[model samples]
Target: MHEPDYGVAGRTAIVTGASQGIGKAIAETLAASGANVVICSRAQERVDPVAEAIDDECEGTALAVECNVREREQVDALVDATVAEFGGVDVLVNNAGGEFVAPFEDISPNGWNAIVDLNLNGTVHCTQVAGEVMRENGGGSIVNLSSVNGQHAAPGESHYGAAKAAIIRLTETLAVEWAPHGIRVNCVAPGLIQTPGVAETLGIDSEQMPEREEVDRRIGHGEEIADLVQFLVSPAASFVTGETVTAKGVPKPGNSMSEGLGLE
Candidate 1:
């Protein structure tokens, strides 16, 4: 009997923002599965250790590249380095983004621009560069990391939410435009994934954390998101494209204020 193959082993994959968190998990997962991985972030110091660790644990190769996705030149350099090291590109994951929590009125124009540039334009840089390599290679998979805020209201994160929502539309458009090139594009929207960095950012002490099931109600692990990314890039999802998979456990309804901005 012929069995199913994920078609990931021996592939070359570039995962941006992979110095830690979900991006690191995804890079590790792909390396362990025998895919040569190029992991990058804004600082070489941040990515070198991750590459070293993956190289030690996985049979496949891992290359560390320093890239600030917001800069198109740096992004192009990153793709060039990946091609030089791995020979070609097969998968690209756009996972670098950050946002600050504040009321819309309190957010400065510069602050809003920073979020949009990092979240939306950063994705554009990586996708366009990597897509070029994919085109030359005949096909590839691109998975973007969005956020649940893109779909729902985030009172304190309006800028980030808007950028992520835009990413969803970009994924759809690219999926269609690149279909002829055999490239697939998709998005993953995660909410409150539990990581050391995230905990520190949110001022949550790890010592007081509950069990996995309890915590998973409101927060998930980076590995959970990594798994979804793997599936999206694997042959199992060959028929899947231009979709946004939300990984925020179960949804719970909430009461809305009487008059924020009525849709009436």
Candidate 2:
């Protein structure tokens, strides 16, 4: 008659791109579960309010840091700040990423590089930096944010799909390589979630999203994704690693190009 234990209370975690959207939801969810959370974004102004809000409402403490995950130095500083505040890192959520829709041929080299750097290189930087602390501390969990587009064909988002696909491969490899160190690595590929960015870019609002119960080709919510992330990083999933969990609603049998173009 015992319930599954999350084992996150009092642990320390860092969630990147936590200023808003999926990242913000993950941070708030973890903090509510009693994990001291450090939330970061590219600008101090962007993440400060989120940290303050988490502090006000959650059981755990929240720290705000300005970090561009593409920069190794910034990633180092973010990890250092986390360790200084909470002693060590027990979890990392690599959620900082961005992309724009354009045909493969229309994408400029600079544009392609920017998207790849942010989505793929940024994850590499954070994982390497925070992973060092996790290794030293005997073990930790890392959850990466990917998208459904990575698994399917993306007509207008070739760069983004490529980067995200790389993340999945990286997760699998790292999971195997780091298993001996007691570290666990996993990836979450979410489908069309109604984040603010999605609302802006795709004209899809949470109000328009179907209820969770009506699970046929519906948009998802950040909280639902957050809940999945929480479980993945918690003791409940102790035996799970090197896996990519897709949280998109049930797939339909047709062209999904339009859906992939606006994946958030």
Top-TM-score candidate index: 2
Candidate 2 structure quality by residue, lDDT tens digits, 16-115: 9999899999999999999999999999999999989988999999999999999999999999999999999999999998788889989999999999
The digit string of per-residue lDDT tens for model 1 on 1-264 reads 876666589999999999988899999998889999999999999999999999999978899999999999999999999999888899999998888788999999999999999999999999999999999999999999999899999789899999999999999999999999999999999988866556665566754444434342446778889888988999989999999999986432231322323421
Clash count, predicted structure 2: 0
Error of 2 at 28 (Å): 0.5
lDDT of 2: 0.91
Candidates in order: C-alpha RMSD to true structure: 5.3, 4.8
Poorest lDDT segment (10 consecutive residues) of candidate 1: 252-261
TM per candidate comes to: 0.90, 0.91
**What is the lDDT of every predicted structure here?**
0.88, 0.91
Give the distance in Å from residue 26's predicted Cα in candidate 2 to where it truly belongs. 0.3
The residue pairs found clashing in candidate 2 are: none
